[model samples]
Target: MNRVKRLIKSVPGSTWAGILLMVFFAFAAKGYLSERNIMNILQSTSALVVLAAGMTMVILLGEIDMSVGGVLTIAATVTGMYLKLYETITVANIMIALLICCAIGVAFGLLNGLLIGYMRFNFWLVTFGTMSMGFGLAKGVTGGGVLSGFDTMFRWISTGRVFGIRTCIIWAAIICAIVIFVNYKTKFGLHIYAIGDSEICAQNSGVNVKKTRFFAYVLSGLMAGLAAVLLLARTNSAGATLGEGYEFNAIAAVVIGGTAMDGGKGGFKGTIFGAIFISAMKNGLQLVGLSNYWQQVLLGVVILAIILYDVINSKIRDKKSLRRVYSDGI
Candidate 1:
């Protein structure tokens, strides 16, 4: 019983909220617990999971990247354009296209890192500028058109199933696992939390705060690029608006997962649950005959509620800590 109590105390409140939501939806929505519906939810959420994983890292480092959606669009556009020009479906060509997409993503990420980390530019302004540039580049490249005709194998990467599970979901799970491991087990991960907690203190402790921050952006870009590829594969088409509003969705998922906006306090476990919860909420609401507009409104309400919960929780923790200090002093 004590062990159970300890475990309950150790888990974040957001996690508990997610559990309650799952239970509620399971009873509230017909067919919500069906295998097919569950798989559909996971498949739909795959891309968002990848994006949120990266966003979690950025937010953990006390920064934000508003350019992921733009980066995703631009990368997908470039890949689609490449495939269109080649007009050939070969393993080598597909690999080359993917590499090109990732390269573009990394390049944009590195630029953001350099400007923000080295030049000490404002994170929001720099990312917003890059976001606009990315959108412009995508529009110019595609001439405001959609690019299609990708190879069968390329499409299969997103659509194919392995053991009755979507390939995209498998890919997302692997990426999330790698990120969670890095966040928990690696020196870089520790440094990320440290820098987020207190940059000056981390710098004094010999952590390369700037380099860590730079790499966080790079990771975010890389994930966005990979997500772009998957998204392109799923849709089999790329347009200027391929990634529209995804950045906001990713941010919303991260915040809903219980990660603090100020940084240094959340884990990927909460994020995974958070992503799943958002997807489930959307699916459940639709199943209940809610319009898309109403679904979005409810999602906004949920986010606001979560934020309020976090604020109240933080204050409670502070008060508890103060009491502990007083008792210790007495």
Candidate 2:
């Protein structure tokens, strides 16, 4: 009984709820439950998981980045252009492009971080502004169009299967593991938790609130860079609008996975499951004959539900905490 209780506590309701959603969808569309279909879902899930890992860090610090889709579109478009022009994708170009993407994310993130962390501007406001700017840059970069055609090497990154799993899935797993390590085994991770738990408290405790938030934003950008590589390769195309709506999808996965949108709690593990669960839900929806329009609507509804659940749970927990404090004569 103790072991079971511990297990239940370890697995948040958000995580379990997401699991149930997957099961419900799979049961609704048995085809989605097949081995091959499961693999397909994972394949599609790999990139999002990467994105979520980044977003998780950002949100853990009580921030958001709406520019990810724009960042992703630019990364994908640039990578595709190189691969198409030269029949070869070089390690150097890959490194450079990723660096550029990361730098862009960090620069924008720092810009946002400065406004929010230093200047007392609202996080959502700064991020939303940057999001618009990022999208404009995306359109400007692509000359307001889409770019496609990928080399075999690039295509294999997304489509290639080895040992019955997609390469991007492998990459996602590796990155996720690294994120888990960073979250669980580092001072930076502690700082993330501290900042999230209570910024005022963390600051009083000598945590460099500005620096910690900056790190979180940098991590967010890094995740975007990694995700772009896998996403472009998998889809075999890029466009100014290729990654439209991805920012919200990532937020949905993170929030759905049990991470508090308000910050201080949650880690990459929940977000990974959240990412996979989301992938399964979308794939299953398609199998159930839902039109693309309805599928998007369903996603929105799910996001709303997750947000509502978070709000209620938070209120209940706060009440419980207050009651405990009163009971203890606080």
Candidate 3:
């Protein structure tokens, strides 16, 4: 009984809520549990899941990266330009294009990290500035147009199924697993949590606070780039507006997954559920005939409610700690 109780306590409440929502939807909505619907949800959510995983690390370090959407667009734009330049499709060409996209992502990510982490600039301001710059560059790349006409192989990767599963879903799962391992099993991950808890304290304890923070942004950028690759494959096209507004969704997934906005208090497991929850909610709402505007409103309400609950839960935990201390003293 004690072990079971401890196990229950170990799981975040948001994770539980997400599970309940899935169960409720499965019962309440016709076809919600169908294999086809499940696959659709997984395929559609793949990119968002990857983005959220990266954002989760950034949030865990108590920083925000507003440039995610722009970075994604930039990556996609660069990939499109590469393909356009080559005018051919080959495994080698594909590899080169992917490398270029990832490099662009890392470059922007590194810039944000250096300015914010080392130069001591404001995180939000720096990221916001970079966001604009990235978007502008993407627009300039194609003169505000779309890039299409990739070979069949490019489309196949995005649309093909391997062992009856979407490739993007597989990519998402792999990324999520890597992030989970990094967060829980690595020394750098430990430093991330420490810095999030208290930067000054972490610094005093010999944690490379600036470097850790910098790397966090880099990881975030890399994920965005990788996500961009998958998204391009799935859509088989790229435009300046690609990935617009995705930053909000990624952040929402992280927050709703029970990762504290204040930082140092979340895990990847909850985030996985959170991503699924968001995707499922959106799909379910559409199926139930909710308009896009109404769906946005409902999502906003849910996010607000979750944040409020987090605030209250934090207060309650603090109170309990105080009570325990007082009781021990007495």
Candidate 4:
């Protein structure tokens, strides 16, 4: 009973409920869910899931990273540039380019962390500034032009399959595994929750709040770089304009996955389920012949509704916690 109670307390309603809703809609769309469709949903959600997983770490520290989308574009461009320069990119070349891309993203993320985490600047304000600067740099790097036709080996990461599963899906599953392990099994994850819940208290408790925030942002940026690779590989194109609206979708997935925007509570599993649910929602709507415009509008509305509920749920939990404390004292 204690173990079951603990498990129930660990995975909240908001986290799993959205997934259930999506599954319900998916079933409603077809007489029976197809295996191909399930694979397609997972494959399409691959990049977003990776993005959200990284963003989950950042947001857990009560921080936001709007520059992730821009970082994605920059990473893809760097990889594409390497592919263009070399007839065939060696594994070392790919690793180096990816490193450079992530390093740049880390710098951008660190900038935001320094300004917001230590300097006490507002999270939104810092991210908003970095977002424009990141995009501007991406534009400058590509000379405001779209770069297309990437190498075949590179495309395999996005388009190819392994043992009947899409490569991207496999990558996403691996990322999810890593995220879950780190966030659930490590001390760093505990610090994330501690800082998110209360920075001053966490600091008093010896948690390295500054380092946690900085590392979280770096993780977010690295994930953006990874997603950029996936996007470029799948499309065989790299554009200065790529990943324009990725931040919104990534945040939506995290929120819908049951992660708190205000921070302190949530997990990667919810975000994983959330990413798949959101992708299925979009795909299912398309299958029903809904236009893209309606899909965007509906997705936005659904996310907003779920977020509002999350806010209320947080408030209720806060009240309940207060009550418990008072009751114990009495």
lDDT tens per residue, model 2, 118-181: 7777777777877777777778877887777766665676678889888988998899999999
Best TM-score goes to which candidate? Answer: 1
Candidate closest to the true structure, highest lDDT: 1
Model 2 worst lDDT window (10 residues): 93-102
In model 1, which regions exceed 4 Å deviation? 1-13, 327-330
**lDDT by residue (tens digit), candidate 4, 219-297:** 7877887787777787788867888888988988887888887789887878887888788888888777789999999
Report the Cα lDDT for candidate 3: 0.86
TM-scores of the candidates are: 0.92, 0.88, 0.91, 0.87
Candidate 1 lDDT over residue span 1-330, tens digit each: 989976875566666767887898888899999999999899878888888888898899888999999999999999988888765678888899889889988988999999988788999999999888888899998899988878888888899999988899999999988999998999989998998899899999999988998998998899889999889998899989999888888888888887888889886777787888888888989988899999989888887787787788778878989999999999
Candidate 3 clashes between residue pairs 3 or more apart in a chain or in different chains: none
Off by over 4 Å in 2: 1-13, 87-103, 113-120, 320-330
Model 4's number of clashes is: 0
Q: Give the residue spans of candidate 3 off by over 4 A.
A: 1-13, 327-330
lDDT, model 1, position 264: 94
Quote the positional error of residue 197 for candidate 2 in Å. 1.4
Tens digit of per-residue lDDT, candidate 3, span 1-330: 989976775566666766777787777778988999988888878888898888898899888899999999999988887888765689988888789878988998999989988888999999999999989999997899999877767666567788988888888888888999998999989899999999999999999998999999998899999888888899888988998878988898888888888789886777787888888888887777789999899888877777777677678778989999999999
Over 4 Å off in model 4, which ranges?
Answer: 1-24, 27-32, 313-330
Name the lDDT value of residue 33 in candidate 2. 74
Taken over the whole model, the C-alpha lDDT of each candidate is: 0.87, 0.78, 0.86, 0.80
